[model samples]
Target chain A: MKLLESVGRIVAISRKEIRQLRRDRLTFGMVVAIPIVQLVLFGYAINEDVRHLRAAAVDYANTQNSRLLLADAHASQVIDLVRKASSAEELEEWLRRGEIRVGIVIPADYERRLEDRKRHGRSARPLAQILVDASDPATYGSVAGLLNLPPPERPGIQPPRWRYGSAISGVSNPPPTFEARPFYNPERRSAVHIVPGLVGVILTMTMVLFTSVAIVRERERGSLELLITTPMKPVELMVGKILPYVLIGLIQVGLVLGVGALIFRVPLRATPQDTIVAALVFITASLTLGLLISTIAKTQFQAFQLTFFSFLPQMLLSGFMFPFDAMPRPAQWIAELMPLTHFLRVIRGILLRGARVVEMRHEIWPLAVFALVMLTLAAGRFRKRLD
Target chain B: MSESAEQVIRSQGLTRRFGSLVAVDHVDLEVPKASVYGFLGPNGSGKTTTIRMLCGLLEPSEGKAQVLGLEVPKEAEGLRRRVGYMTQRFSLFEDLSVFENLDFLGEIHSLKASHRRSRIDTLLERYRLADRRKQRAGTLSGGQKQRLALAAAVLHEPELLFLDEPTSAVDPENRRDFWESIFQLADEGTTVLCSTHYMEEAERCHLLAILDHGKLVANGTPQQLMDDVDATVVEIQTEDPRRVREQLAGMTGLLSLAQLGNRLRLLLHREVENPVWQVEEELDIDAGATVQVVRPNLEDVFVVVTRDEVS
Candidate 1:
C-alpha cells in the first residue's frame, strides 16, 4: 500500500513536469524540434569525398608520350585536367592560388630518354614530377601516392618480359597501363563521413541542455518545497522527470533520420528500430549526465557554464570534426572518458556501416554503466529535502 | 472531540540547531484536535522551524515530537500523506491550470478519479475560483493564487493543515475570507496549526503560542494573553506629543507608548492618581486635544510579551 502511494505521487509529479515542459516553447523547440532540423542539415549537406581534383599539366617536352600520359590522367575520374600550362611557373601559380591540387610537369628530355633506353638495351626512368599542395594533409597525401605508382604493364606481358623494339615510333608510343582504383569513399565526400557522427552530436547537445536545467529551476522557484514534502522517492522522481526528455529525444532522432533519407539521400543503412534503440540509449546516458550536472550546480547560470565547459571538450576530443587517430595522445585519452566518444562510434557504425546490436554491445554496456552510476549519484544528491 | 483523546501534535523539548544557533529551542507545545492553533512571532522567531518539524519536513535535534499521533522522523513519510502544508509563498506549479494543480495534488494523495473530480469541482465552487479554473496558476492575481494554493492543499481533506503565514501578502478583506475558511475547517473537526506575524489574524485562533528568540514566552487564548499583560492603555492627544513620548518613556509606571496618527497611546501598569491630569498639567496641548482610556488589543499584549522577553 505504501509503495502504491509513493508511485502515485511520483506519477503526479512527473505529469506536472511534463505540463511545464510543454508550456515552455523555447525548451520544447530546442529539445524536440531542433534535432530534426540538425539531422536534415547534417545528413544532406556534409560530404567527405575528395574526387574530381583539378590539375594543371605543364608538358614542356611537346612529345606524343607526354600527350598520351596526360590523356590517361584525364581519363581517370580522380583528376580533372583543368588547364594546359606551357611552363612550370604557371603550374606553381595555380597551386598557390588554390586553383589546382596537383600539377604534372613533363621534362623536355623525357621522350629523348626513352629513345636512348630503347637503343642501349637498358630501362629508362622518366623525370616528370607530380607536385601536390601539402596544406590539406589528408587529401594531398592520397593524391601524392596516386601520382607516384609505377605505370601499368601492357597486355599479355609476362613477368620480367620487355623488348626494346625499334618500331616504337620516335619514343612517342609508350606501354599500356592499368587504372588506379579507389575503395570505400570513391567520391571522398566529407558529408558521408560527418553525417553519421552528426546524429550523435545533435542528440547529445539537446538532451543534456534541457535535463540539466529542469531540477535547478524548481529549486530556485521554491516549487521544490512542494515536491520534496510528498512521499515520492528520489529515484522515482528523477526517472519520472526524465521520461519526457527521453521520448522527445527519440522523436528528434526519427525526424532527423527522415530528413536524412528524403533530403540528403543518406542511405538508411540500418533498420529504423535499431537506429532508434541506439539513440534511446545515447539519450538515456546523456540525461543521466545532465542530472549529474544538476546535482553539482546551484543555479541555471552555473549549470549552463558547466554544461558548455563539458560540451566543448567532448566536441573537440570526440573526433566529430577531426580525426581521433591524428590527435595528440593526451587529447585522445581525454576523449575516451566522454560518453559522446562511445555514442559517436555507435551511431556511425549503425547508421553508416549497418552494425547490429551484438556488434554495438561494447558501446551499449559502457553507456548503461555510465547511466547507472550517474543516475544513482544524482538521485542521492537530489533527495526530497536538501541535505 | 473527547478531552481524553490525544492531542493532534505533541512535542517535548523539541530543538533544532543550525551549527551553534538554536533555531527551535527546547519548547513543548500541544495542539488539540479540531482547534485552530496560531504560532505568533516576529520574523526569525522559530515559528517556521517549529512548523517544519510538526509537518515532518525537518528532524529535531534533541527532542521527541509526534504529529497526528505518529512519532516524527520515524513515521514522517506515513504522516505526510495525512498532513497538508502550505508554505509562506505560493508554491504551486505555475505552468499548470487551477484544475490541473488540484487534480495533481489529489492524485498524489491517492484520491480516486471520481472522488478527485468531485473534490476539485467542489473546491473551485467553494473558493469562488470556478470561473478562472482554466487560467494558468502564474497568471492568477496574488489573492487568487493564495486561494488556489489553499484549494490544492485541502484537496485531500487531510486531517491536519499547516499554513505558514498564508495571508501575509493578502489584502485585509481576502484575509477575512481566508480565516473564515480556516474556522469552517475547524468546525468540520480538522486540526490546524498556522503561524502569522499579523496580530489581528493571530487573535482569531483558539490558542496562540507567542515565540521570542526561539523560546515560547507565552501560550494562551488572545483575550487571556491580553489580560495576562494587566495594563491600561490611554490614548493622548497633545500639542507636543513627541515631548510627552520622551517624558512618558522615563516613567516607571508606563509600559509602552504607540503613536496613533497625531496622538500617542500610553500603556500603564497601573492607573496612577490622575495620570491624564498629570500629563495635561506638564505637557502643552491645544484646547481641542482629547485624552481617552480604552481597552487593550492583541498588539498591546504582543508588545508586553516580547518586551518582557527582551528585558
Candidate 2:
C-alpha cells in the first residue's frame, strides 16, 4: 500500500516536471527540434557510394583497335572521361591536380606495332599505362580495376625500348580479368552507412545528455528538495520526465527515415510500423539510462561527464562504422550488449533489408534489458529525504 | 520530558551526529496535542535535523522518538501519512502555477478527485492566494511562494504539521499572516512543531525550546523563561555609549552591556547593590545619562540564558 502511494506521488511530480519543461523554450528545442533536424540531415544528405571517377585518355596509337578500346573506355560505367590529355605531362598534371581519378596514356607507335606483330608472329607491345589517384581508398578501388585487360600488340622485330618504362607484359595470359563487386555498399558511396550511424549518434547524444541534466539541474536549484517533500514517488517522476524526450526521439526517427528514402534513395528494409516500435524501444532505453545517470550525479556538470563516458564506449563498440562480424569474439559479444548496436541493426535492416519485427527480435531484447536495468537502478538511487 | 496520553510527540535522548559535528545532542522533548510548539534556536542549532527525525524523513543516529503517537524511524511511513512537512526552502515546481502545485501535492496523497477540489479551494482562500491562482510558482514573490509552500504542505490535512523556518525570508506582514494561519490550524486541533530564530515570533508561541550549540538550554513558556531570569534591563540614553560601556565594564554584577541607538542598556544582575549609583558617583555621569529600570523582555532573557560572558 505504501509503495503504491509512493509511486502515485512520483507520477504527480513527473507531471509537474513536464509542465516545467514545456515552459522553457531552449530546453524544448533541444529535446524536440534538434532530433528531427539531425535525422533528416543524416538520412538524406550523406551518400557513401562513388558515382563519378574522372578519367582521361591519350590516343597516340590511332589504330581501329585503339579507337575501339577508347570507345570501350568511354562506354564504361565506372570511369568519367572528364578531359583528353594529349601528352603524359598533361595527364600527370591532371592526376596531380585531382581533376581526374584515372588517366590513360596510349603510346605513339600503336598502329605500326600491331601490323608488325600480325606479320612476324612475334609481338612487340605498345605501352599503355593506367595512372590512378590513391586518396579516398574506397572510390579509388573501382578506378584501379580497369587495368586487368589484354596487353597492347608489339612489332614483328624486337622494338626499340625507351626509358619511359617496360612495355606492358602478360598479354593474352588467360585468366579471368577482375570483375569487381562491392559488398555492403554496391554503389560505393559514403552516405549509405554514414546516415544511419549519424542518426543513432545524434539521438543518443542529445536525448541522453538533455534528460540526464533535467533532474540534476532541479536538485541544484533547490527544487528537488521541494519535490521530494511532497507525496510523489521516484518512478512517476522518471516516467513523466522522459515522455517528452521519447516523443522527440520518435520524431527524429521519422525525419531520418524519410530523408534516407527521399534523398539518398536508402530504402526501408522493414514496415514503417516495425521501425516505429523499434525506435520506441530504443528511446525508452536511452531515457531510462539517462534518468539512472541523473540520480547518481549531484550536478548538471557531473551528469554531462557521466553521459559523455557512457556514450564513448557505445560509439566505438557499436558496429555503426566498422563491421562487427570481423571483430574478435569478445568485442563482438560486447557490441551486442549495447542498445544502440541492436537498434542500429534493426533500423538499417528495416530500411535496407525490409526485415520484419520477428526478424528484429534479437535487437529488441537488449533494449528491453537496458530499460529494466536502468529504471531499477535509478529508482533505487533516489531517496525521499533531504540529506 | 514525558507527557500524558494525549501528547502527540515524545522524545527521549534524541540525538543526531554528522561526522565529528554533533548537530543534535541527547535531549528529551514532549509536545502536547493541538498546541503550537516552537523550537527556538540560532542557525546550526539542529532544529532542522530534529524536525526531520520527528517527521520520519530521517533516522536519528541514537535515541527514540514518537511522533503522532507512533515510534519514529520504525513507524515513519505510518506517521508520514498523518503529518504535513514544509521545509525552509520552497519546493514546488517553478514552472507550474499555484493551482497545479496544490493539485499535484493532493494527487500524491491519493485524494479522491471529488474531495481534491474543495480542499484546494479551502487552502487557496485560507492563504488568500485565490486571486493569483494562475501565476506560476516561480513567478511569485518570496512571501507568496512561502505561502504556496505552506498551502501545499497542508493539502492532505495531516494531523501534525512540521514547519522548518517556513517564513524566514518572508516580509513582516506575510510572516504575521503566516502565524495567523498557523494559529488557525492549532485551533482546528492540529499539532504544529515549527523551528524559527525570530524572537518576536518566539514570544507568540504557546511553548518554546531554546537550543544552542546542539543542546536545549531553556524550555518553557516565554513568560516563565523571563521570570526565571528576573533582572533589570535599564536603557541609558547617552551621547557616548561606548565610553560609558568602558566606564561600567567590570563594576559590580553587571550581566551585559549593549549599545542601542544613542543609549547603552546595562543589564544588571540585580538592582540590590545600587551599582547605578556607584557608576554615576564615579564618573559624575548623572546629567547626560537616563537611569531607569525596565521589565526584561524575551531579548534580555535570551541574552541571560545564552550569553556566557566572563564578568
Candidate 3:
C-alpha cells in the first residue's frame, strides 16, 4: 500500500510535466525540429574525401611527356589544373595566394630522361618535383598520393622495373602492393561515420540543455517552493520530471536514425535490441548530467551558460570531429571523462561496426557509471528547502 | 499537555538563521485550530521565513517546532500532505490551464480519481474559475490567478493552510474576495496561517503576530493588540498637514506621525501629559486646526510595536 502511494505521486508529477510540455508549443517544436535540421545540415556539409582540389603546374618541359604527366594528374580526379605557370615563382605565388593546393614542376630534361632510360635500361631517375601546401593535412594527403603516381603510358618507354627484383624471382620478390580496403565504409563517406555519432551528439545537446533548466526555471519562478510544500520526495520528483523527456529523447533518436537511414543510407549494423540498450544508456547519462547542472545552478540563465560551456568540451574532445588517437595524452585523458566520448564509441560501434553489447562493455560500462554517479549527485543536491 | 490538543501548530523558540543573519528569531506560538492567524510585518522582517519553518519547508537553526502534532524536519514529509501552502508569488505552473493545475495538485495529494474530479469541480465553482478553466494560468488576470492559486492550494482539503502574502499581487477588491474565500475555508474547520503587510488584512484576522527584524514584537487578537499598545493616538486636521508633520517630527514622547490627506495621525508615548494638548501645542494649532484623541487601530499598534526597531 505504501509502495502504491509512492507510485501514485510519481505518476502525478509526470502527468503534470506532460501537460506543461504539451502547452509549451515553442519548446515542443524545438524538441522535434532541431534534430531533423541538424542531421540534414551536418550530414551533407562534412565530407572527408577531398576532391577537385585546384593545382598549378610549372611545366618547363613543355614537351609531350610533361603534358602527358600533367594530363594524368588532372585525369585522376584528385587535382584540377586551374592555371599553367611559366616559372616556379608563379607556382609558388599561386600556392601562397591559396588559389591552388598542389604545384607540379617538371624539369626541362624530362623527355631526355625517358630516352636515356630506354637506351641504358635504368639510369638516374628523372627529377619531377611536386610542391604541395600541406597546411590542411586531410586534403594534402589525397593530393600528394595522386601526384606521386607514375606518368602516363608511352610506346618506347617501359615502366620502371621493381627495385628489389621481379615477382617471379624466388630469392627476393618486389615489395607487395600496399592495398588497403576499409572494412565497413569502403567509400569512406564522412556521413556514414558522422551520422551515427550525430545521434549521440544531438541527444546529448538537446537532452542536457533542456533538462538543465527544468528545475532551475521552477525555482526562479517560485513554483519549486510550492512543490516542496507537498509530500513529494526528491527522488520521485526527479524521476517524474525526467520521464517525459526520456520518451522525447527516444523519439529524437528515432527521427535522426530514420533520416540517417533514408537520406544518407547509413547502415544499422547492430540488432534492434543492442541499439535500444545503447540509446537508453546514453540518454540516461545525458539527462542525469542535465539534472546535476540544474541542481547546482541558481537560475535558468546560469543553467543555460553551464550547459553551453559543458557542451563545447563534449563536441571537441569526444572524437566526434577529430580523431581521438591524434589528440595529446592529457586531452585524451580528459576525453575519457566525457559521457559523449564513451557514447560515441558505443553508437558508432553499434551502427557502423556491428558491435554487440557484449563486445562494447568497455564503452557501455563508463556510460552506466556516469549515469549512476551523476543521478546520485543530482538527487543529493536537490534539497526540499528554498535555501 | 491537554492544551496542546487545542493548538494545531505549537512552537517553542523556533528560529532560523542564514549565516550571520537571523531570519527568524526564537518565536513561541500556539495557533489554535479553526482560527485565522495573521503574520504582519514589513518586507525582510522574517514573516515568510517563519511561515516556511512552520510549513516544514525550512529547518530551524536554533529551536524546534511541532506542526500538526509531529516533530518538524524529521516528520516534515508526513506533515506535508496534511498542510497546503500558497506562496507570495503565483507559483502555479503558468503553462498549465486552471483545471490542469488543480488536477495535478489533487493527484499529488493522492486523492482518488472520483474524489479528485468532484473536489476540483467544486473548487472551480467556489473560486468562480469555472469559466476560465481552460485558460492558461499565466495569461489570467491577477485576480483570476489568485483564485486559481487558492483553489489549487485547497484541492486536497488540508487540515491547515499556510498563505505567504497570497494576496500581495491582487487589487483591493480582489484581496477582499480572496479573504472571503479564506474565511469560508476557516469556517469549515480548517486552520489558516497567512502573512501580510496590509494593516486592514491583519485587523480582520482572529489573531495577529507582529515581527520586526526577525523577532516577534507583539501577538494578540486585533482588539487585544490595539488595547495593549502603550501609546495614545491623536488626529489633527489642518490646512497644511505636512507643516504640522514637520512641527511634530521631533516632539518629545512622539512615537510616529502619519499624514493622511489633510489629517495628521500621531501616536504618542503613554507617558505624555494630555496627548491631544501636546500635539496641538507642538503643531501650533489655532482655530483652523482641530486636535482630538482617537481610538487605537491596528496601524497604531503596528507603529507602537515596530517603532523602536526602525529607529
Candidate 4:
C-alpha cells in the first residue's frame, strides 16, 4: 500500500507538470524548436569545407606555362582568379585589404625554374608560391589541403619538380607530400560531425534550462510551500518533476536524429538500441543538473544565467566546436568533469564510429555516475520550508 | 465542549531563531480538538512562524511541538498526511484548473479514485466553487480563489487545518462565507488553527491566542481575555476629538488609545486609580465630553496584550 501511495503521488505531480507545460506555449515550443533550428543552423551554416576563395594572380612569367598553371588553380575549385596583379606587391596589397583570401605569385622564370627543379630534383627553387590568409577561423578551417593542385602536368619533362606546397621554405620533398585521406566521413562534411553532437547540445540546453526552473518557478509562485505540506516525499517530488521532461527529452532525440538522417544524411552507423540507451543516460544527467540548479537558484532568472554559464563550457570543450584532443591538458580535465563531454564521445562513437555500447562503456559510466550524484544532491538540497 | 475534551495541538516554549532575530520566541499552546482556534497578532508578530513549527514545516529552536500525537520535525512526514496547511500567499498551482488543484491534493493524500472524486465533489459544492470548476486558479477572483484554496486544503479530510491569514484578500461578505465553511469543518471534527492580523476575524474564533513579539501574551476565549485584561476600558466622547487624542496620547497610565469616530476609546493601565474619571478631567472640552467605562472587546484585548513585554 505504501509503494502504491508513492506511485500515486509521483503520477499526480507528473500529470500536473504536463498540464502546465501544455499551457505554457512559449516554453512548449522550445522542446521541438531547439533541435530543428540548431540542427539546420549548425548543420548547413557552420561548415569546414571552404571553396572559391577570392584570389589574385601575379604572373611575372607572362608565358604559356604560367597561364596554364593559373587555369589549373581555378580548375581545382579552391581559388577563383578574380584580379590579375602587375607585381607580387600588388597581390600582397589585395590580400591585406581582405578583398582576396589567396594570391598566386608565379615567378618570372616559371619554365626555367620548373626545368631547373626537374634537373636539381630536391634542391631547386619552386616555380610558384600561393599566399593564403590564415588569421580568421573561417579562413583557418581552410583551403590548406585543396590548394595543393599539381603545377600543370607536362608531357615531355619527365616528373617536373616545383611542388610548391606549404613547405616551400626551401626544403623540398618528392611528390605526394603528406596527403590527408579522411576516414569515417571521407568527404569531410561538417554536417556529419555536427548533426550527432547537436543531439547532446540541444538536450543539454533545453533539459537543464527547463528543469532548473521547475522547482524555482514553484517556489516563486508559492506552490512549493503548499506542496511540501503534503504527504509527497522529497525524492518523489524530484522524480516526478523530471519524469515528464524525460519524455520530452526522448522525443527530442528522435526528432533530432531522424531529421539528421533525412536532411543532413548523417548516417546511423550503430544499432538504434545503443543510441537510445546512450540518450536515456544523457537525458538523466542533464535533468539532474537542471534539478540541482533549481535547488540552488532563488529565482527563475538565476536559473537561466546558471544554465547558460554551464552550457558555454560544454559547447566549447566537448569536442563540439573544437577537436577535444587539441585543447590544453588542464582544459581537457575540466571537460572530462562535464557530463556532456562523456556523452558527446559516447554518442559520436556510436553514431559515427559504428562502435557498440560495450566498446563505449568507459564513457557511458561517467554519465551514469554524474546522474546519480546530481540526483542525490538535488534531493538533499530541496527543503520543504521557506527557509 | 466538555472539560475532558482532548487537545489536538500542544507546545511548550516553542522558539525559532533566524540568525539573531527570533521569528518565533518561546511560546506555549494548548489547542482543543475540534475548535476554531485563532492566532491574533500584528505583522511580524510570529503567528505564521508558530503555525509552521506546529505543522512541521519549520523546526522550533528552543522547544518541542506535538500535533495529532506526533512529534514535529522528526515525525513531520507522518504528520503531513493528517494535517492541511493554507499559506498566506495563494500557493495553489495557478496555471491549473480549480478541479485539477483539488485532484492533485487528493492524490497526494493517497485517496482512491472514487473516494477522491466524491470528496472533491462535496468540497466544490460546500465552497460554492462547483460553477467555476474549469477556471484556471490564477484567473479566479480573490474570494473565489480563497474558496478554492479552502476546498483544496480540506480535500484530504485531514484532522487539522493550518490557515495562515486565509481571509486577508477576501471581502466582508466572502469572509463571512469563509467562516461558515470553517465552522462546518469544525462540526466535522477538523481542528482549525487560523492566523490573522484582523481583530474582527479574531473575535469569531472559539478560542484565541494573541502573540506579541513572538510571545503568547494571552490565550483563552475572547470573553476570558477581555475580563482578564490588565487595563481599564474607557470611552470618551467629545466634539473636538483631536484635542482629546492629544491630551491622553502619552499618558503613562494609558496602555493604548484609539479613535472610533467621535469617541476616544482608551485601555488605561491599572497603575492609576479611577481611570475613567482621570480621562474625563484631561479632556477639558468646551463641547463637554462624556466618560463611559465600557466593556472591553477583542480590539482592546489585542492592544493591551501586544504592549506587554515577553515574559
* lDDT digits (tens) for residues A14-92 of candidate 1: 7888899889988877765676666655543321334456788888876666676677777764567889887888886
User: Alpha carbon lDDT of residue A141, candidate 2?
Assistant: 62
In model 1, which regions exceed 4 Å deviation? A1-11, A36-185, B1-5, B19-21, B230-232, B253-255, B268-293
lDDT of 2 at B100: 90
Per-residue accuracy of model 2 over A251-310 as CA lDDT, tens digit each = 777776566657766545567788788778888888888988898899999999999998
Q: Each candidate's DockQ score against the native complex? A: 0.44, 0.39, 0.64, 0.63
Better of 2 and 4 by DockQ: 4
Q: For residues A34-138, what per-residue lDDT tens digits would candidate 3 score against the true structure?
A: 898888877854424566677778888788777888888788877788898999888765554445667788888877764543444323354477766543334
Candidate 2 residues lying further than 4 Å off, grouped into runs, are A1-11, A36-185, A321-337, B1-3, B230-232, B270-283, B308-311
List the lowest-lDDT window of 10 residues for candidate 4 chain A.
A174-183
Interface RMSD of 2: 2.5
User: What is the per-residue lDDT of model 2 for residues B196-247, given as tens digits with 9 covering 90 to 100?
Assistant: 9999999888888988777887889888988777566777777777777777
Model 1, span B1-311: residue lDDT tens:
57536589889999999899998889899889999999999999999898887776778888999888789877887876788888898888889998998888788778889999998999999998999999999999888999898887788788999999999888999999999999999999889999999988999999999998888988989889887766777788767667677666666577788897778887777656676665555455544457777778888888877888888
Which should have the higher TM-score, number 1 or number 2? 1
Number of the top lDDT candidate: 4
C-alpha lDDT values of all predictions:
0.75, 0.73, 0.82, 0.83
| Order of quality (DockQ) | 3, 4, 1, 2
Model 3: per-residue Cα lDDT at residue B25 = 89
Superposed on the true interface residues, model 3 gives a C-alpha RMSD in angstroms of 1.2
Candidate rank order under TM-score: 3, 4, 1, 2
Displacement of the residue A188 alpha carbon in candidate 3, Å: 1.1
Candidate 4 clashing pairs?
none
User: Which has the higher DockQ value, candidate number 1 or candidate number 4?
Assistant: 4
Fnat per model, in the order shown = 0.56, 0.61, 0.89, 0.84
lDDT accuracy of residue A167 in candidate 2:
48
